[model samples]
Target: MKKPKKPKRPMLAFAVTEIDDHTGGIVWARTKKAARIKGAARWGYDEPAYVTCRREPWADRFHSKPLPVWVMVANGWHFDCLGCGIRIDEDLPNWQDRCGADDTFRDMLREARRYRKWTPQCVIGHQHSDVFCSQDCKDADDAYRAACKRKEAHAISVFQAKVLKRFPGVTLVTDRDRMHPHAYATSRKRGIVVQQVSVEFEFPGMRYGPASLRWDSPFSSSYRKVEKPYFSCCNGDRAAFEAYAAATRRAAQEPTDRDHP
Candidate 1:
């Protein structure tokens, strides 16, 4: 969990400004422990919000000790794409390129954050960010997943129609929340695969409504087919997918073709 960086505050006399506890004003140092405070004085604070470093005028008195680097420098921040694993130490704003900045970790530092805004497609790559290096990395991980909703919906319409057409009396059962969603299709309440929901078909005395399934392939999952049912984000309906392999194993089936007799 990354915390938001607070806005830069001005220093009064510069002893590593920190929030004062007693006076509810700026304390001189990151913290007593972190800043290694040597000496300090009292304060005159009013209603104190969160422990924030307060800004004060120029110091009319003198301090005994000096402070260390408690602030972020122009080249202090660093980042690696959690998705692509690229040490984004330079500027990269293009989403189409294989590796480039998308402003995920823009500026905790300084120069490279801005100048590179004009300089796209850096020869060597190394940008600064907190977590993900690029926006593409985030999307690849589906950070903002609109999901394969259209595909799932299409499967539902097509498969439901297919099942109903084959047997009018047979009923089709569906529950979006039959299973939990995974990286491919998430939400325990939503039986989704990648972006589509699982489905099922039932006979006159069979179960209808809620069902779950997953069909795995490199194209759909966009990678290796995982054996774990839940881990499989295979695109397509799950209605009877789990039963497919077993059914095939039990019966040696072949495509039948009519010959001209």
Candidate 2:
């Protein structure tokens, strides 16, 4: 019968030792204790300080003793397979070959913490770490958003047409000035401008009732609206509009009592 083969063990490449800050070189020895003693002898001081050195790449420095459990816990260190949550033992020589968990310990810990509460899943039931499972899901989401934008554009165009028919000869100023007024007009006498005019309609969700008309005369910097029942000032009634325009023109032309002799 053939003899059973012994399992191979993993080995660490670097040893922890005190470094000479002046020279930027490691004070190395056969063991950590020996390195410490050598550091004390060279510097004439007894202090426990060490750093990792890779001068001897094949050296098995940390094989004898594993890192302390307390230190590992405090530093939030762990190795686990992301696919199955299986703990990976780095001490085994063939650990990487067995589970393929090659991510650094710190990186694995960060990923675990980030997805602790929820693991993302696609609409089709595929599990993943990203917002969608695959490119197909991402494309579908984009298409849905585009369709919503198109529907909204159609509705706005229909509303704008209605407004144009209702208020002829008025300029439609959207964009930043959407809240200013629905439509605006420039009052002219013999093709020469006299005053600025704007009209606001009473939509379904308006806070106030009836439409409103505003006018900016030479004397005022901003357009002023008449008190409630302002709709009577315009509202496509020729007689009402003529009376309101005449009153405003007279007010602008006449001087106040304060300026009279």
Candidate 3:
């Protein structure tokens, strides 16, 4: 028989900032130690939300000290993409040249900047701080972390060279640690990529909505057999789109509802 795994404990932590739409400040939990709630801390409005960081199993002489590289969100802060794996193919190398007249990357930044203006002005990247992790990891976790950062940096550089061309006055601002905003915008310039709530949209003359939607594409929808792909922001709008469905079912009686019955 296999041994059963033990349940993990919860840790107590604090939120460093007040996220705009979030009801409470974010929290950081350490060591899997749960904290008890008190009057204000336990109250519905004042309840303290927490996030936890697991302690690395290897605590060696090197582990005792922080790593040389900047700390990833895994250590303390929680940074993630709000719109990942959508139809963001335009940004990829293979599909780059396809979107000419309409570019989705622009739409992404614009949409990201609209409501969450606080993202650029204040949100910080993990690289800005001295918190580093051990380079000793000889596993997949280490490789994944490195790759994610590289992807972000490469994307940012591309934005600086290509996207900012139209807007001449815009310039990029980076810290020594390379930590910026999830998506930062300046007086004239804005960030390259940022996370936001899910978005859905539909263009004219499409039957089924696309899994993901982009505002612009270099490809000509008019020339193609299909006009343009449309998308819904949320999954709840399918009923509104029934008319466009390619398939439908009809109820019938015996012998295909023949009048002879």
Candidate 4:
């Protein structure tokens, strides 16, 4: 007998509700539960764990808030063709750090795996992963809290530079408010350490640009085959990006009746 289809629930993450494009169904992650687990995983214990989903290619707009939330689904270490399965930490007795924090990350992962249409990769917080800024910290002392905030921001900048080098032709944009006076003073007062040299201001053909250039055509256009959607514009090794551009140009040059007439 065919199993009955389960009713679609709104996918929610970072306290934001998810809306499915195909089914037009709305999904919001159980944020309170997920956040509780996530916080517990990261700050509340010796080691933290939680389950989350890889944000699909284009699921950012519907969020009432800004883009790039930290909540994600974590499938354990195993993979079953589609992608990696739930992390091995889920059921093991000493799974949290013993299994790399997969157990604590398991709550939402179980649900995502049942669907089998998506995958997971761990996303640390904004400072660690370049997502967002969060003031939520266990340290209640004002000075300590201020210092941590600066640390978080500094971590983000270091990671940002690393990402830029890893992805060529990638463009990144950050808000001005991110550099507000309070942010700078806090960093100075706290004595933030510079880990890596900042990304070069200019690299040949790799100037900062709009985010649109990151995604390639999912389908073949009249002109050429497009590339897949990439996380950042800086993707593609030297050879790959060049080859793609050459092919696109060649396709564009093809003689067309419309052009000649």
> Where in model 2 is the C-alpha error above 4 Å?
1-130, 176-261
Q: Where is model 4 more than 4 Å wrong at Cα?
A: 1-140, 168-171, 178-261
* Ten contiguous residues minimizing lDDT sum, candidate 1: 252-261
Inter-residue clash pairs, candidate 2: none
Query: What TM-score would you give candidate 2 relative to the actual structure?
Result: 0.23
lDDT over C-alpha atoms for residue 166 of model 1: 38
In terms of lDDT, which candidate is stronger, 1 or 2?
2
RMSD of each: 16.4, 25.7, 23.6, 21.7
Q: Could you give candidate 3's per-residue lDDT for residues 190-217 as a string of tens digits?
A: 3222221112224233345422221222
TM-score of 4: 0.19
Worst 10 residues of 3 by lDDT: 252-261
TM-score of each: 0.30, 0.23, 0.21, 0.19
- For model 4 the local lDDT of residue 143 reads 56
Best by TM-score: 1
* TM-score between model 1 and native: 0.30
Error of 3 at 110 (Å): 46
Across 119-186, the per-residue lDDT of candidate 1 in tens digits comes to: 22221222222345444445655643454554445645644554444344444655447533222444
The order of the candidates by lDDT, greatest first, is 2, 1, 4, 3
